[model samples]
Target: MLINVCNLNNNHELSTTEMNGQFVQSQLQIASLLKMETTSTDQKEFICKCRELYKDNKTQLHFVDEFER
Candidate 1:
């Protein structure tokens, strides 16, 4: 259950169960937001906001996993 949020353009890893749960919830929220009948520009703005939130809360970023190809 090691989810790599960075792979999804995030800067953190969902290492713990709690963090993973939050990640899932965040993803669901993003999906719901995207589903709204908004303009493309608004969708992009929402995505940027989500990314900023993740980036600000990220603790372990820019670390390369040697085993990952």
Candidate 2:
């Protein structure tokens, strides 16, 4: 699920709040994708790849949250 936030003005700039919301939404979408892929794919390699991607994204999210606070 891609969440697109459009600016009303021509510049199309996103505020900090909007950016953060997008990040969170993207993370959730990634997690959902991982869950779906895990159930559909029986390959261990695919599952490991999904888990690594999830972990990387989760770490980035936490870092951003900490930096913001």
Candidate 3:
């Protein structure tokens, strides 16, 4: 059996599938660092709450406060 994936391009710019995959993997690693058993769970309540509080906040400021060293 074989699976095929097609790259979608928009406005002459190719979508960065490789970069997206890497970003997803990085997110999984971050989730693991949080001791999360699954990325999708009610345990994500904390993330939801934080988003609600800072939805318009710049990520750089938040990341420096939350994760970046």
Candidate 4:
């Protein structure tokens, strides 16, 4: 897993496994912070945020596979 933490906070440095753990921890933290075990509104907001972030980051990744060959 070629995880990228380039957008993470300045004080953090995460390896692949650490990055995976961080992702799980992030979902847990978000759920806890919102004080919900499961809620549609919370889920929707989280999904939207993730989608936007993914799109932004994906655009930044100019992989060789995407080049005009």
Report the C-alpha lDDT of model 2 over 17-57, residue by residue, as the tens digit.
87777778778876876777443345545445555556768
1-69: candidate 4 lDDT, tens digit per residue: 123423467335667787777778777766666684767776666555555556657653343224312
Q: Flag the better candidate by TM-score, 3 or 4.
A: 4
lDDT of 1 at 9: 41
**Local distance difference test scores for all models:** 0.54, 0.59, 0.55, 0.56
lDDT string, candidate 3, 1-69, tens digits: 122233344424635676577567767766766694554444355555656676788874485356422
TM-score of each: 0.35, 0.37, 0.30, 0.31
Largest TM-score belongs to which candidate? 2
Model 1, range 8-59, lDDT digits (tens) per residue? 5443544677567777887987787668786777656655655555575554
Candidate ranking (lDDT, best to worst) = 2, 4, 3, 1
Model 1 vs. true fold: TM:
0.35
**lDDT score for candidate 1 against the true structure:** 0.54
- What CA RMSD would you report for each candidate? 12.6, 10.7, 12.8, 11.0
Candidate 1 segments exceeding 4 Å error: 1-15, 39-69
Model 4 C-alpha lDDT versus the unseen true structure: 0.56
> Which ranges of candidate 2 are over 4 A from the true structure?
1-12, 37-69
Please give the lDDT score at residue 58 for candidate 2. Answer: 81
Q: Which residue pairs clash within candidate 1?
A: none
**Cα shift from native, residue 47, model 3 (Å):** 26
Please say which candidate is ahead in lDDT: 1 or 4.
4
